[model samples]
Target: MAPSEKDARREARRRAAHRRVEPDAAPAGETAIRSDPIRVTADLTPELYRHLGRHASRAAEEMDLPRVPSVDLVRAWIRVSDDPLVWDKVIKELRRAKQ
Candidate 1:
């Protein structure tokens, strides 16, 4: 039996998702890292949310980035936190906040 229109659309979408790009297809001076990114969620106050958005926007403009996603900024912070000095500072702030 012939597939219905819905089945055809589904097959097309599946094929599109599976399509792979050539390793060298990235634009000049750009490196593409293909990896599955997992989602991380955080709870923030409305004021903090606005602050994050504004910070990301300003950084994006200053750095000539096409966009500065909040996730990217948070990931950068995580990378920085790997340093002993930054880690210590974060712990100090946490302790002070608890007092």
Candidate 2:
């Protein structure tokens, strides 16, 4: 098949085995891991003390950020956490937070 036809078929397959690669390489000194938005899952212990809504409220109040749902904060954290610089910030802030 032609190059374009192959790519089209791969895209339309809607299956992991038929994935097509697009050249969106990260720049220098950056990791290409998780370069695109993806849906990941976690089975949090719901009975645990802390939860997203409460944390989100506290973060908004302490950090003077907009009052959005805590899920947004968690999602944004996941997106940036792979970066070392941002990870450092996470470490700093988390260390400062109450354990």
Candidate 3:
């Protein structure tokens, strides 16, 4: 039996969703890393939460970092904590050179 119009539209959507890009097809100076996302939950005491808020605010003022929520700071730390060596390298470079 012939496929219905709805089936054709579904097939088109699936193809579009699964479309892959070749690295060479990217424009100059562009690179891409593909990975699945991970979700984690945290529970902190009220004191620690307050501490994080104060520290984040102080860092923003003293270090000129943008002020983000404490939870965001925690989330970002968790994300970048995977590579301590790279973090150290970048921190050293940033300290040596003006951003």
- Quote each prediction's TM-score: 0.54, 0.37, 0.37
lDDT by residue for model 3 over 1-99, one digit each (tens)?
Answer: 357886986676555444435334544223333344767776778987788888789867876777867666777776885798868976887789675
For model 1, the superposed segments whose C-alpha errors exceed 4 Å read 1-37
Question: Worst lDDT window (10 residues) for model 2?
Answer: 13-22
Ranking by TM-score, best first?
1, 2, 3
| Tens digits of per-residue lDDT for model 1, 47-85 | 989999998998899999977999889888889999999
Candidate 3 local lDDT, residue 43: 79
Worst 10 residues of 3 by lDDT: 26-35
lDDT of 2: 0.67
lDDT of 1 at 18: 47
Residue pairs in clash, model 2: none
Give the candidate order by descending lDDT: 1, 3, 2
Model 1 clash number: 0
Stretches of model 3 off by over 4 angstroms after superposition: 1-34, 79-99
Clashing pairs in 1: none
Best by lDDT: 1
